[model samples]
Each structure stands twice: as structure tokens, then as C-alpha cells.
Target: MTKLIHVAAAAIFNPEGQVLLALRSKQQHQGGLWEFPGGKVEANESVLEALSRELDEELDIQIDHAATRPLIQVPYHYPDKSVLLDVYKVSGFSGVPHGAEGQPLEWVDIANLEQYDFPAANTPIVNALLLPQCIAITGNANGTAEYVKKSVAAISGGAQWLMLRAHQLSSSERTALARQIRATIDAADGVVLSLNGSVAEANDCGVNALHLSSDKLMVLNTRTEFRGRWLSASCHTIEQLEKAVSLGLDFVTLSPVKTTATHPEQPAMGWQAFSELVNAYPLPVYALGGMTAEDVDQSCQSGGQGICAIREYW
Candidate 1:
């Protein structure tokens, strides 16, 4: 068996939402490609310590450790080696970032990251970067007009990602509502709309993504044909999370982080349990159920991509 090598990487972002990418030297592993600034974790240092040390060594900046948020962990295998990448988002830092190691560096816009070549392990990191920290879901609106109004408000309030989820609507009604919401989202310029239904429904509605219910998640053994569309699942247990990962879904929302009105009887996972589950998995997981935008920082610290709220967010 090949031993696992641990690497700590940082996605250092600027105020413009552009993340810093380092052009690996031609002689280095995965060289001549743009990658996040980081290095191998030393035996004696924690992942956080290694991350802070590496950023200072490679970029000549001191990261505010308190402000660092755990982003994603990616495990990839090359022909000769296996590596576990521990990545974090560095938001606060002292000193300007420069290529202190004599390697080329550039701040690339999050949306255009795919234009450059990156290591296979970094693909998920790039996807996570493109996703918003808070995903607003249109919850239990009384009518199509009400749903559209709330969705527009959410988008206008700076929510770049949204899930239109009026499960009570009939098939025809749902389709019509989806079209109206999609038009509104497009008018907002580049907002991503995810429909809470099956692949066929999402495709028919012409949405950007699909959100699978937990029951849908359990029945699927393989990824669906939603080419060019993001796929997300609602996960409750580790088993559900593992299933979603096996199906290669883009992200999952681990729910009931706190007791929600919809499921008051369901037990809450709490922050500690939620952290444990996410840390054990590599894919980005969002804290769902009774979450608000104000809980984003806490969610990040708990190893979540962010909060996926239905009630509070809307």
C-alpha cells in the first residue's frame, strides 16, 4: 500500500474575490501548472501550523490564523504517489502577497479559474471557490407570485446561488414558476439557480443545477446525466453523505444542525457532530436547517462550505 502524504494549501483571496494561484516551477511535482500556494505538512506541525508556515514562506504574508476557515480536503492519487490536500480559505493577512519563492503568481478571478491548467486534485477546490458561501432556498411560499417575489429579494440582497423549492406546487405550476424564477435570476447577471427536483425536471425547467432530495439520493447508484449542470444532495447521515460522494455529486447539505420548525422532532446534529462528519469527508458540505447568513462564520469554522438556509435566508 502506498503511504499517504499530507499537504496544506491556502486559497488566499483578495477583496475582488480573486484567489491567488502560484505557477509551479517546471522542476516541481505537477509542475508548469497553476496551483494554490502551499507545501507538504511536516511531521511535527499541525495542518494549520503548516499552512501558516507555508504561506509566509511562499507568499511573504502572515495569515491571521484566527480568521482562517477550513475549506475542503482533496485526496488524489498519481501513478507514483498519493496525497491528502488540506485546504483553507485565508481572508485576513498582513503584508502584500508576492512570489517569495521565485515562482510566478497571479490573482485569477474565481469564475475564470478553469481557463488555466490545474492539478486534478485542485478541481474540486476551484468548484468550491465558484460557489457562494450562503445558498438561499425559497421555502414554502404560498403561491408562485410569492415565491418569485421572495426569490428576487434574496437575489437582490446579494445571494448568488438559490434553490427554488416549492414542493407543494403541481408539475405544471412548478414548471411555470421555474421559468419565471430563471428569468429573474438571469436578469441579475450570473446568479445560479438550482431546482429542487429530479434531473429531468431541472433540465426541462432550464436551470443551472439540481438539488436531490434525500430519498432521491438513496436510490441512485451512479451520477445522473446533467452535463454542465451542478448536482447537489441533501444528506442527513454519514451513510447518505457517503452515497452522494460515491455518486460524485458536487456538494451536499447536512441538515438539522439545529432543530428546525419543519422537523422539530428530528434530532439536531449540533456543531461538534457536524464538524466530525464533514472533516471525515472530502466533498464540500453545507450546514442546513435553521441556519441564517449570520451563522456563516460559525459554519465555516465547523468545516462546512457554508450555510444552506430555507427559512431564515428567504
Candidate 2:
């Protein structure tokens, strides 16, 4: 096995909601690329400890340790090296940030981050940052009317990322609901709606984001081309997560973080297991099953993008 080089990185943000980035020195590996500021984790130091030290050394900033939370862990392999990037969100910090090490620093709007070049390992980090902290998944609904009404409520209640999971509805019903929701999203800026169904269904709906069930995820040997901007999956185990990553998915939802009323018999994985599983891959993960809007911070603390809930979402 290749030895993993552990690196601690920070998605440092100012009060303006812009993230701080640094330009990698041309003399360094993956040079001329923009990267989140961080450095290697020493054997004696914890990831947080390393992150604080690295930020101080690199940018001369003091991060508020309490406000720091695990963001994402990325495992990337090059021809000659392997690295495990343990990243954190630094929400509270004290400093007028500068290039303490001579590298140029820039605070960029989250929307404009894609305009800059980044190393392959940093791709997932960008995606994680771009995703909304609260995701609303539609649960049981009586008909297209209820689904549309509930979906609109979710969007109004601040769920920009909505997943329509109406398995009980007919294909045509689902399409109707999707079209209505899509129109609503179109009128509102930055709202996204994804379908948790088959490609055929997605095509019929003509939506831009598609989410696959775990069963569908395991059946695919490779990522089939889809006419969508975002592709995500439902994952329960490390194996499922591996497949999702292999498919180059945009993100995934790992379930049973807590026992739900619907699946009360199924043992909950709890937060520790969820965190452990999320660390295995680079894909942005959302804590699903028994999640509520209030659980977003806890989810982020456990290395998740945010909470994805059905009932308490809207």
C-alpha cells in the first residue's frame, strides 16, 4: 500500500461569506493552481492542531478553534504520491489575512470559485463548499397537488436543493410534480431540484439533477451518461460509497444517521459511524435519515456537507 501523506486544510471564510484561497508556488507540486490554505499534518499533532499551525504559518491568521468543523476529507492519488486531505471550515477567525509565506492570497465569492484552476484533489472540496447546507427530500404525499405544494413550501422555507422521492406516485404524476417544481425553481434564483428515480424518469421530467437509489447505484458498473448537471446517489456502506466515487458522482447521502420513525427497526449508525464512513471518500456527503434542519451544524461537525431530511425540512 502506498503511504498516505496526511494534510490538514482549511476553507477559511470571512464575514462576507467569501472563502480564502492561496496560489501554490510554481516551485511546488501542482504549481500555479489555487488551493485552500493548509499543510502537512505532523505525527504528533491532531488534524485540528495541524490546521491551526498551518494557517498561522501560511497566512498569519488565528482561527477560532471552537468555530472550526470538519468539512470534507479527500483522498487523491497521483502517479507518484497519495494524500489524504483533512479539511475543515474555519468560520471564526481573527486576522487581516495576508501571504505570510509570500504566496498571493485572494478571498473569492463561492459562486466564482470555478473560474480558477485547482488541483484534482481539490475538486470535491469545491463541490462540498458549493452545496447548500440544508437539503429537503420529499416524503409521502397524496398526489401531485400535495407534492407540488409541499415542494414549494420547502423552497420557500430555504431548501434550495430539493430531492423529489415520490416512489408512490405514477411516472406521469412524478413528472407533473417535477415540472411544477422546476418552474418554481426557475423563478427563484439558485434553487435546484433533483429526482430520486431512474434515468428514464429523469428524462421524462427533464430536470437538471438526478439522484439514484442505493440499489440503482450498486447495479451500475460505470457512470452512464446523463443529461443532467448533478449526479448523486444513496449510499449505506463504504462499498456503496466507493462505487459512487468510482462513478464520479457530484455528491451522496449516507443514511440511518439516527433511527427514523419509518425505519425504526433498522439500527441507527449514529454520528460516529457516519463520520467514519464519510472520511473514506472524497465525495460530499449529506447526513440522511432522521435528520432535521437544526442538525445541520452537527452534520457539518461530523464531516458532512449538511442535513438532508424529509419531514422537518419544510
Candidate 3:
């Protein structure tokens, strides 16, 4: 049996939501086809450790604190070799992305990853990236923490990832609340603590990443200072999605997978429609727009990393 090459890669996105695709040398097997920058995993290193090392050696870039965003774990197979590709979003790097392996490079939008011919093994990865997601902050009502009593209750029930979309709180008040949630979430690796609209608050609160509205997403493009954080955004259309991509957002909420009870007045893009829209998307997408944890498995089956739901949380 051929030994599987442990591999890692960086889907480095530019300010336009375009990903950096390295073109292979004419001598390579997948010559002329484009790919994310990375290389084979080495011995005894964690996948992330290997990713960091490989990116530096392969692209001559440093994986700084903010750009180190996890995208997905992919499994691919070739005639002679099998590979497990641990991919990440290089959101913040010190230098221009280059191909240290002597391959040419191009930065393509995430939606275009499939357009360029990559190895067959990378197909699933391409899909994982295109799916949209929505992370709901259960227990909070209409962007205000009534008491945080409901928020506490919801987490106990099942909501693993919670965002404090508390719009009404004063900065000091919200920061305190986020810090409290962070303390609670620290124990649950599966649970993430995210904050709405404030990178400074998130970093100070010690949460996971930032969730930006399309408005906010647009404002932050080309700004690499992360406050040492994970970043996400909200997208309604392909255009906004590109902005998120360019900014190197860690994740995002692309909503209304189903006709949402909360937003019934708003039109919905059914599952088929959502899948079609997301076809060939290049980043990890969580099926948002009215989905639940129960729907997560189905979302992955359809074309997403999983489903992110506000209603089903806890």
C-alpha cells in the first residue's frame, strides 16, 4: 500500500475574497492546474504545526496569529498517493504569497476554485468551502441580553457555539458579558465564544472569532491587524462573499437555508437553491438561513461543512 502523505495547505485570500492559487511547474503531474500553497506533512508534528512549517517553507510567509484560521480537513487520493490535506485560511501573512516550490501562482475567487483544474482529491475540499453557515445566539432576544439567564439555559441544553449579538449593551457591559461566556466556553472545546461587531471586544473578551455583517465585512478589507483573533462575516450574495474572502474571514453566516420562522417576511432560498448558489464555493461554508443541528448532517450531505442554526441552538 502506498503510504498516505500527511499534507497541509493555506487558502490565502486577498482583499477581494480571492484565494491564492499556486500554479504547478510544467514538470509536475497537475501541471498548469492551480492549487493552494502547502506541502507534505512531516513526522511528529500536529497537523497545524505541519501547516505552519510547510507554508513558510513553501510560500515564504509567516503564519501570524490572526491568519491562522482552520478551514477544513480533506482526504484525497491519487493513483500513486493518498493524502489527508489539513487546510487553513492564511488571513494574515508577513510577505507576499509566493511559490517557493517553483510553481507559478494566481489568486482566484473562492467560487472559482473548481474552475481551475486541481487534482481529483481536492474536489471535496472545494465543496466544503462553498457552503454557507449561520451561528445563532440562543437565549438572547432581539440582540439584547435580557438577563443572560436564557443564554445560560440554552447552552445547557445544546448550543455549543454562541455569539453575543448584544447590540444594546454598552461597551464595558458587553465586554464583561463576553468575558463571562468565554470563561464558560473555555471548558468545551466544541463550544465557541464569538462576539458581534467588535474585534477589540473579542480579543479583550478572549473569544474565538469575529462575526461581521456585510457592512462591517466591507469596511475591513486589506486590514491585516487581527487583534490576535479569528474572524467571520455575514454574506447575503456572492459579491459580499468575495469581500469576506479577501479579508480572510475565518467563517461567516450565509443565512436562511430554509424559510425561517423568524424572518418569514424575508424570501428564502430553498435547499436546492442554496446548494446551487454554493456550487464550487472555495471556503468552509456552514448552511445558515434557517437550519438546525439536526440539519447539520444533511447540510454536509448536501454540500456544506455543516449547518449553523440560531433556532436549534440549545
Candidate 4:
């Protein structure tokens, strides 16, 4: 078995919403790339302790314990070493951060972070940071026109990300609905639209992102058609979440955080259990099934990205 190195990392942000990044020196492993600043966790240290200590030592900053939250934990393996990166979001901190240890530091805009080269392990961090907090999924509509209208309304009601799941519609109807949604999304700034269907349908609709149902998520071997685009899945268990992580998916929606009319047969995983399952594979997860706009804060506190809903979000 490969020895696992436990590291605590921080996605420290400034008041302007820009994140702090540090450049690795030429002598370091994965050198010449930018990375979130952090250090290895000592045997006796807690993750928060390590994070606070490292930030204070390396950047001369003090983290506000109340404002710190769990971000994502990444388990990455190199040819010779394996590491588990326990990441946190440091939104509240006091200090003008600088390169206290002679490392060059940069404050980068979140959207522009992609211009810089990052280690493979840092890829998921970028993706998570780029994602929106809430996603509105279109429920079953009477027709294609109604679907488009409802989706546009959801966007109008402060939902920047939308998942169009009109599976009841035929291919041509679905394409038309998607095109209308795309047109409205294109008009707005930073709006993202994804299709909840097959790759062929997504391609035909001219959208770049595809969301997979649980069954489809289990059967995929590779993201052959979705290499450059965002691919997400709906997962319910650790196994399904593990499959998503292994397949290099962008994000996932874990369902039944509470009892819902849609899937009453499936028992609700209360906030505590949901947190436990999420901690096992801490991808950017949106709480689905019985989720509403009101549950966003609780979801975030329970280690979720946000809420994915059909009714309440719309």
C-alpha cells in the first residue's frame, strides 16, 4: 500500500473575492505551477490547527475560526507518492498576505485562475471554485415551450445555473427547448446551462455540459465525449460518489437529504448522515431531493456545495 501524506490546504480569499495562490519554487515537486498555500499536517495537529498555523507562518495571516469552512478533500496519487489534501475556505482573515518565506504570491480572480498552470491535484479545486451555489432543474413541463418559459423564469429568479431535464420531450422538441434556453443564457453574464440527457442530445443542443442520472453514471467507463466539457452526475451513495470521483467528474448531486414526494420510497438521509457520506468523497456536491432555496446555508454547513431543486428553485 502507498503511504498517504495528509496535507491541509487553504483557499484564502481577499475582500475582493480573489483567491490567494503561491508559486512553487524550481526545486519543489510539481514546480513551476501555482498552488493553494498550505503545509503537511503533523501527527498531533487538527486540520484547522494546521491550516491556521501554516497561513500564519507562510503568509502572516490569522484566520477567523468562525468564517472558515470545509471546502473539498482531494486524494491524489503520483507515481511515487500519494497525498490526501484536506482543503478549507478561509473567507475571513486578518492580514495583508505576502510571501513571508520568499515564495512569490499572487491574488487571482476566480474566473481567470485557469490561465495559470496548476498541478493535476489542483484541478478539482478550480472546478469547485468555479461552480455556482444553486442550481435550478426544470421539472416535467406540459410541453417544450413551457419548459423553455419555466427555465427562463428560473434564470430570472436568481438561478445562474440551470439543468434542463425535459426527458419526456422528443429529440427535436428537446433541441428546440435547449436552444431557447441557450439563447436566454447567452444574453446573460456568467449563466450556465446543462442538459440532463445523453451526449448525443447535448451535442445536438450545442451545449457543452451534460448531467447523468444515477444509472447512467454507473455504466460509463470513460468521459470520451465529454473531455473538454463539464460532466456531472446524480449520486445517492458512497459507491456512486466514488465512481464519479474516479471518472473525473466535475460535480454531483446527492439526493434525498430530506423526505420528498418524488422518492418517498428512498429513506431520507438527514443532515448528519448526509455530511458523513459527503465527507467520504468530498466533491462539490449539491443536496438534491426535497431541497429548497431555504436549505442553502444548512447544506453548505453540512459540507455540500449547495442545493439542486426542481420545484422550489423555480
- Number of the predicted model whose lDDT against the real structure is largest: 2
lDDT of each: 0.86, 0.89, 0.67, 0.86
lDDT for position 180 in model 4: 85
lDDT of 2 at 138: 89
- Ranked by TM-score, top first: 2, 4, 1, 3
Q: Compared with the true structure, what per-residue lDDT tens digits does model 4 show for residues 1-314?
A: 88779989999988899999999998988988999999999999999999999999999999999989987777788897888888888899998899998999999999898899998888878887899889999888777567778877898899979998877888787878888879877987788998888767777878878999889889888877763378999998788999998888989999888999977898998999888877667468889989888898898888788889888856
Candidate 4: give the clashing pairs: none
User: How does model 3 fare in lDDT?
Assistant: 0.67
TM-score of candidate 4 relative to the true fold:
0.93
Candidate 1 lDDT, 145-183, residue by residue in tens? 788888988888888898888788876788788998888
Candidate 3's displacement at residue 242, Å, is: 0.9
The C-alpha RMSD in Å for every predicted model, in order, reads 2.3, 1.8, 14.0, 1.9
Candidate 2 lDDT (Cα, 0 to 1): 0.89
Stretches of candidate 4 off by over 4 Å are 1-3
Model 4 scores a C-alpha lDDT of: 0.86
lDDT of 2 by residue, 1-314 (tens): 99889999999999999999999999999999999999999988999899999999988889999988888999888888999999998999998899998999999999999999999999999999889888889887776677778888888888888998888878787778888878867887898899988777887788889999999888866665667778899988888998898889989999999999999998899999998888878889999989887789888888889988988864
Model 3 Cα displacement at 139 (Å)?
Answer: 3.8
Give the number of colliding residue pairs in candidate 2: 0
| Segments in model 3 whose C-alpha atoms lie over 4 Å from true places | 1-136, 141-152
